[model samples]
Target: MGQGDAPERTRRALAAAFDPVFYRTVYDDIARTGSDPLRHYAGTGWREGRDPAPWFSAAAYLSRYPEAAGGDPFLHYLDRGWRQGCEPAPSAHRERFLERIGARPHAVGAGPQAAPRAPDADLPAGLGRKAARELAATGFDAAYYLSAWPDVAAAGQDPLDHFLQTGWREGRDPSPDFSAADYLEVNPDVAAAGVNPFLHWLAAGRAEGRPLRFELGFRGRIVARLTPLEERVAAAAR
Candidate 1:
């Protein structure tokens, strides 16, 4: 990425905004190919109308701003489209999402949503234990959960057991990058059904490409997808 002037500036800004892990996790096909996520998106994925992140939809944005068709929709959004009140998703949904994000309480450990959850006795045996196990193997962070909820940590609870019993309904996050409120907000059905949001996502959402949380903490796992020569150039500059 030995770039200069306006193009390079945009590239770096987009790189900063990009989340390689989020891209790969959302699209298993991209992960399966082992291509650098940003490289793919910059080169062809965007042209294919693929989204760069969960919060931004390329095709949807393009539909709103056809003038942006000549350039990358993600770049355009970061560049100026958002200032123009562009939406990355359906207008109504995006409005709600923006309001939720702005409120901030929708984040970890905010307590059970306004809606109640089924009592512990009503939960199936090992409700989210399986999903929790699978996510742990993939990227779930139980320690993060405890850290977010001091009471749970103070009580020396088994992180998984507590989450299965009460933590989720209380809006406790299982992983730092996953927000129960964010998931439920986008997926009202999961919230309505009383199914574990994380479980529903793991068992079904992954295949469906349903939206979920992408915490700000892990924004750039691998966005700098420059070639080896470019890497050397960047390292030399550093």
Candidate 2:
């Protein structure tokens, strides 16, 4: 490779790892301008600590591997970071994604492990419309949903629609304490049935006392917490 080919090589590598739809959707300023997501990212996004996809958190990557600074995180990872066993998204599905990248190191930027997990953001709505609508009428928090998955907001799809259609199955969490992935992981029946996890919770999990996420559980209900609890239920609960 000639020195002149470096820029093109870099672009190709970044393009393989970068996700334009995720970029435009997650970041409001970019979405508002409707600029080419890749151009913006290559030009300024990485410098500003912007992530390429849900599986890759730029800020986290830089923090974890400060040596990756002054260049694109994806390039560093694809070139040698993965070989060094560098982590991408610490908060996302780290294990599964790690397996994916390790298995297909050359295809780092092709797509997230979304089909085995990611629904193509461009595909027409198919499965989750009704579940989404039903979820909408419930105490579904739109603000929280957007904050949790800014990509959803960027994609221009309704929050519930995305959740029911893609979010739940993809393991996108609906709230701070509720994990869509965990709910599905613990319940293969629900996963196989292809029912929305949150909807399943509302319809049956709540009655069945299904746990949400690993960290989302109540830790044996501390005695001090009882002071704030409703007295009527506290006595029996304790």
Candidate 3:
């Protein structure tokens, strides 16, 4: 191929391997860390003595499974797809791919297996260990939740129960607070459509048949979306 053609070919190949979500994740990390994400991934420039062979090669291979290239499923397809450069596989096959890489598929609702019991012990008295552990597994800081809202505990309610029933229902800033309950409170027009907010969120996403980053936030003027615990739970149930 001609020299000019090489760059375009490489671009296409990389595009195939790394979807928008991959780029977004890298950019998000950069914003969060205030560092150069491309430098971390590919170095100075594509031709500035930084070897692009590995990434380009992986991209070429990943292009074959374009259907699995973005959002949540992208991670599931990445390693094996890069190494094997094969056609897309079913969920069962993907599970096996994880196994082949010495990894196990993550279980839904499974809390951190290694989190110390100390956090649970810090929960208000009368809350059971199981309930505390369940809240922690949901990815929120359990201790922070307790400390942030003492009134829930003072009423002798389980922290998780209060979170599901009330705390999440309260409104906050749109960015970083797009919980099902909060979203409904904020978007009364949507709520007026006469559907359950939580279910509507799930149904809309399902209809699109694509991964959504629900929790939105601004990092230095850039709007970023992230999947939250409530959405994760809804996804698991679906």
Q: Over the stretch 108-189, how does candidate 2's per-residue lDDT look in tens digits?
A: 5676564553343222224254554665447577779998788889988898677766676677767666666778655545
**Model 1: lDDT of residue 48:** 77
TM-score of each: 0.40, 0.39, 0.24
Q: Write the per-residue lDDT of candidate 3 for residues 18-92, one digit (tens) a residue.
A: 323233332344457665544444443322222122222224323555554442233333333333444333222
Candidate 1 residue pairs in clash (backbone atoms < 3 Å): 112-170
Q: Report, for all candidates in order, the number of backbone clashes.
A: 1, 6, 1
Answer with 2 or 3, whichever has the higher TM-score: 2
lDDT measured at residue 106 in model 1 versus the true structure, 0 to 100: 44
* Best first by TM-score, ranked: 1, 2, 3
Candidates sorted on lDDT, descending: 1, 2, 3
- The 0-to-1 C-alpha lDDT of every candidate, in the order given, reads 0.68, 0.65, 0.41
Give a tens-digit lDDT track for model 1, residues 142-212.
77877888898899998877886677778888887777898886665566556777666766777888678
**Model 2, poorest ten-residue lDDT window?**
214-223
Stretches of candidate 2 above 4 Å error? 1-4, 90-238
